[model samples]
Target: MTDTPGVSDPVAGKTTGASSAGVQSSGRTAARGMAWTALSLVVSKLLSFGSQVALGYLLAVDTYAIFALLTTAMIFVNGFQNPGVSKMLIQQHDRLDEILPDYSAFALWLGSIGLVLFLVVGIGFEMTYDVRPLFWVIALAGLSIPLKAATTVYMAVMSVNYDFRAISMAEMKRSLFYYVVLVGAAALGAAGYTMALALAAATLFHVALLKRATPGLRLSWKLTPRRFWQMTVEMRWVLLSSFLFALGMNGDYLLLGEMLSAEELGYYFFGFTLVANLTVMISMGINQALLPLFSKLKHDLAQLRRQYLRISGAVTLMISILCIGLVGIGPMLVHLVWGGKWDPAIVVVVSIAAVLPVRLTANLAGVVFESQGAWGWRLMTLIWDAGFILICAFVGATLDGFNGATIAVALQRLVSGLLTFPLAANMIGIAPRRTVGFFARCFTVYGAVVVAMLLADPWRGVSVHDSTLILRPMLETAAALAVFLAYNLAFNRELMVAMLGILRRKKTP
Candidate 1:
């Protein structure tokens, strides 16, 4: 049997026998870390969704939009402070204990700087735009920056040490705090409640937990100018790549906010958040499991490729099916679940769902590059964004004014999927044509399933008021999905086995 990525290669084959040992050890460690992160993510997403649901019911969509804008602006400003040094520390080969303190100090100083920046920017934006309430949100949300920076380092330590239990507990605490606070504060209404809950969860709670978690954690300004310079130099490229990727991923919301009204943006944002959450769950789960192990098994490219496809294909398949089903029944489900007020979101919901597989694929590509220490590929994210713009423009020209924009957003994902071919090829060292073909196959499968569902619909005779009208779409969609999965598994037996293995392991001890 051949060695697998994150399973059989380490030290680039220089110390073959010993490297195998490290790979074995690291795999277990990374798996443990992933387990904890998964737990936290699950809990956090659940609580967050529930909180949002309650808030939405109580608050108007406009208030939600305000909350969204504040959160987005805060994220944009704080982006400058986080430069990925935490990953550098975690991924390095040695001396984590020594490395941890430097990172801690750097985080503190960066947080301080970030806090000041937030204040200045918050005041300026709020005053100029008459968004004074945002000033308070920014001021309060500012605390998450340093706390995030610090928690980031602490999480890095956990990953490096493979102590996922601690990491999971910390996240669980954070999520629980957010839900409890949000629920309690919702009594007062939306804006204040959201702000208060965010502060408690992200800022104060994080800091307290981080401090308790790291008994000896300390920060100092003792680092030499030379070291700081080196850190900056190394981090700049990674930061650039990360920023581009984040911008590309997030820019659509900004665009929507500018091009459309608040109500439209609100619908788009909610749908986008829902789909993005699903993508995050799958992509992050695999990545968190794979990256640390990849550090140990860097040489086993073949194994890496196999494992990559196995995990990625499974995720892609699941997301694809869920997305297609949503497109068919999403509007109905949204109406049924959220009530009449959220009816506007149904159109955008299906539109956003259409691009989920593409988004997930691109996210996976980023994870691959991140694991390989390939910062250059980050530029591809911008290229993908360019495609988003192009497709958005195309859809706008073809469809009804605002509806066109929303549809264009989904079309952008398809364009992004096509655009990422070369990037994926470069990252994986596969032929560009072949790599494109692989993704094309995925798209074809998903599209075929969707097409079949549409074909089966009895459009000629179907009545809107008939109970069977609603059930018909669901039934046809389910059948199409069954066919899609059967075909997918038949063509990719290894992938199916791997997915089965993953599921079995989850069920096992």
Candidate 2:
């Protein structure tokens, strides 16, 4: 109930020297954690990308579509497995080890329930859809739930210790294992079942490594009902929040599968995968590292607000650049890599790219809300997002098919960002206008880049049939990059300089 040692209550609007020192220390640790996470993500995503490319080439579109559907269902079920328990563990600054046994027990129980639920649902899905392979893949993947749940507990322990290096290493191993298994299975002509098998194997291996990495940690089946009940009470909103967020994010995949053809869903899945990869690189790479740090600073709203803005700005800049790059060259990249067979996915990718900056910003806001113990607000935001996107997506799918659904999804994201930004800002005592100004400045840069891209479109006069596909995108990308650099230099020079200075300091020490 009381503020942690060296943490000042935000309402007091004051801090001692010790609190300031504590804040600085936590900032450094968070930076280090983020660096490790970034490294892990870069390596893991590269492997994942390679696997996806291989699978894309090896499997038929309809087969890949089935895999994507089952994978999404597995992930949705996993989302319910002790949703906020890990976060609750991370938020605690004391008695963590004392609490581990009960937490572990709860996680195992939830995971068991999740596994059974997934099997029941998978069977029903098979019966209803008459897709036998779907049930098999889902059933096999369901085996990983308990392992993943156990891994989650250990990862939370590592996070509380600020030991992200171990976590990153475990992730790298998991990715490597997955990559090898996926390629081997695909090569053996397993099709969709390849992904399901790979996921289960990799998750089992990952849990083993995580257990080894976390010293003195052992899985327990002993549950303390009182402690479990207290944690459940504390985390009920967090669980709801997690479920709603997952529904908001992944519900579209389900919608597309049900409402559209398999080929259409496949195309949408490819584009969604690309966008989701970029998002994971930004959101999980940066935001997860910030969780522990924000928890440390939650009592000091001033520090938390400052850190949130600075980090959000930097993340916005990175996401904006990636989105712009995607807009300028993503279609060509798709053609070059996956061949023109995936040309249908190009529009979907571009539509999703339109809202990446806003979606990512809202994601960061969710992190802030969770860190500040504002789970109710976080849940409300997620509910609004889920409702808006599902309605828009259904309407769009009914009217104009997959492309329309893509545009509708992007619009929903923009609307959610607009609605949530001010609320998140206000929760931290930041003026809503300041939040608006921040995004306005960020989007101004984005808008300039977009206009420059339009003006720099190298294929404007060239016929698509005659133009050199590779050369056109390359030239256009170069032009867009040059314009972006010029704009930033001319207008955002100070911000650039400050970022460079921070990097310089980090390198020096």
RMSD after CA superposition, every candidate? 4.9, 3.6
Candidate 2: regions farther than 4 A off: 1-23, 130-132, 224-234, 451-469, 489-509
lDDT of each: 0.62, 0.74
- Show pairs that collide, candidate 2: none
* Worst 10 contiguous positions by lDDT, candidate 1: 7-16
* Residue-level lDDT tens digits of model 1 in 1-509: 33443333211322334445554444345445445555666687788778767766766666555555665565455445565766677568477777776666766666667788878867765764433376777677776777667766766665665655676687678768877777667756646347545663655687678678777766455667677677667677765664565556555554555556666666766766566666655554555566666654445664455345545665566568678877777666666556667767665666667677876776666666676776666555655575466457445735665578777767776666565634754555455555656676577878766666546542322225457676777777777777878877778664555444443333211
Q: Model 1's lDDT to the true fold?
A: 0.62
Off by over 4 Å in 1: 1-41, 127-132, 190-196, 207-230, 281-287, 383-401, 452-467, 504-509
Q: Write the per-residue lDDT of candidate 2 for residues 206-243, one digit (tens) a residue.
A: 98898889769887988777866776676678767767
* TM-score against native, each model: 0.83, 0.90
